[model samples]
Target: MSDHEVVDEKPEVESTPKTTETATEAPEDTTAATPKPEGNDGGEESGDDMPPLEDIKYDDETDDAVKKKRIVIPEDKPKPKPAEDGWLDVLDNGELRKFVLTPGAVGQPRPERGCIVAIKLVVKLEETQAVVESESHELTDMIVGDSDLFQGLDLIIPLMDQKEVARVVVSSRFAYGKTGIPGAIPPDASLDCELHLLSVQWLDEEFVLPIVDRIRIGNRKKERGNFWFGRQEYSTCIQCYKSAIKLLDATDEELESLDTNELKEHFDQQMKGEKKSPEDEERVKELVDIRGVTYNNLAMAQMKIDDFSGALTSVEAVLVTQPNNVKALFRKGRILAEKGELEDAIKVLKTGLTLEPDNKAIAQELNKYSAKRKKELVTERDLYKRMLQTDKSSPPTTPSKGLWGRSSVTGLGVECNC
Candidate 1:
């Protein structure tokens, strides 16, 4: 039989009327209508080629349970390492760090507020160690607490002394921060700096030293000025003396109220009492003497530079403190003479001579000006005499023009030819 033929062992039963009754009675049974073998024509079961389907059923409990379930995932993160040792937490705020490469002078005066400091600086990237800006040879002057330097530097420089070199690490918050300088530093980049403190000039404390030390320092400067003066370095000498004078706490007006000897006597009297110490008295005397000498040297330098007016001022300062100061008096007289104030010069020289009658220089200056004055007086007298004789020899008269075409002298009544 062909594979398409249906074989039935109950073929005799299907031809019977009972089989027809059974199909009519179960007319709604479609499963019985189509009959086929469980296997295909190839004799392999078709059911084996496909998997069975499992029934899917749902309830409220099942849906609630499904909604309550959560998915958990592991996150990946980097671990932080500990900070390196031997780094100083500068600024105490942890925004800056420092490591000293080399130390500078010990016990030197640190910079104070409003003082100007000179520094050499280098800036680099903290990560790549790449140089960003460097100022090595040319030192930049910054005023403490008042300059436009980086805030980190302004905070750090006050702790350092002259000639100090340090390596500082500034955090991004303290450095240029997120908005860094274009073309110079990167954004949000930490900076590495190499700093050198060169010099400091404390303007606030320039005149606040102890009187003894002030006079001692002034004397030292004056000695240096004398050395320079001997070498004919007039400009340098003037600068040194000026620096010495700037150390004095007294003003020109204050020094003018009392002469040097009177100041010494008053200081001695004050010392005898408990008001001032012996050391203080000595310092005051020295200061007064040194100030007079400084003024004299300054005047001499000014004269050398052809600054006669400046020389006059300096000498007058000296004369104010020491009215009998011979050098100051002589220089003042000379300056006056140079300025064509001969009368004032004569009076100044005469006063100096009264103080030192035996001074040959003063006497000679007085005699010279006196002789010049006498000569001037005689010339004036001769001029007046000539005018008087001419007026006396002629009477008031008017002359008309003669036949010649020449103007005649009227008062003299003299006629001239053409």
Candidate 2:
């Protein structure tokens, strides 16, 4: 159908509903939602755009997942411990410090006493097994449980028996602290030392101190041994010789003060070397002769001091080396005399005189005894002659045989009186 025709026909019928006059107010005032700033997005802002800082609250579900980060420090960290049967890490810094329990308990527990120990040790750096120092000594003693030691050593000694063995790496604080073993180690350094407890006993007041000082001095010498050897080889400068002689002389002086007669003699002989100048062959020979002379003189001193055995040994050595030595032969004779072997003494003296016929000292010694014997013989002979003369001067008087009871005899001719 033609739309216009049907619509006009229907509209002409005036299809309109009854209108009740209902009043409608104007649409309430409407407001539009404002757009947030660039920073605020659903309530989230860029870190830069946010205030300097703000605390953000979190939910329970996320709290457990977000952990509190913690920092672990090595120094404060708990040290790993070991079992009693096994090796224990007593200390741990850059290196590991360990202590081992001995088989038997320490005998005569002496916390207050101290004793010398002979130790065989092998030292190595951390994590690597290369020995930096290895040695054995019949010395080095520590007072047990005393803090005057490396911390590691202090711990180790208390746990050891008299003959126990303890292995350890001494920490920096225990070993050398910040300043390490001067030329051997740097500052804040650690060292590994194996200590074997060879023995223990009560401390000897006189023995401990000198021995400790000796050990420390020996350690210093060990540190300088190679250097000295090299210097001795290539540095024969007069200054070096002077320094050596100074040391030798000082040793001699110390021995002399100690009354160490043998040691003093050794030092003296070593110090009194060949003269500085040898102008001729004779001078050189004289210089060479000094050693023998000093040796003999020392032997004589020993003999004077009643070190008979020592004197005998020294003189014997000299005789083996120099059979024709007058000094040695004379010294032997003197020693034999002191020992009360006058026969042996006379023989040795005679042999020496044969070798040194014109030695006035030897001749004088022999002549002194000879002259005394001759004077005694002369006195005895003169006494006998005097007895004979007395007999001749006064003739014997005999009584007349039968008749005369008594008779008097005169000298020269018998004159009787009855």
| Strongest candidate by TM-score | 1
Q: Give per-residue CA lDDT, model 1, range 152-228, as digits (tens).
A: 78777876768888888888777666766667777888888898988898765523544555576666667656655
User: By lDDT, who's the top model here?
Assistant: 1
Writing each residue's lDDT as its tens digit, candidate 2 over 237-343 gives 22222222122222323324333323344333433543322232332233223334434544544554477777776667557536787767777876876776656
Count of backbone clashes, every candidate in sequence: 0, 0
Local distance difference test, candidate 2: 0.48
- Indicate the worst ten consecutive residues by lDDT in candidate 2: 2-11
For candidate 2, the clash count comes to 0
In angstroms, how far off is 256's CA in candidate 1?
A: 10
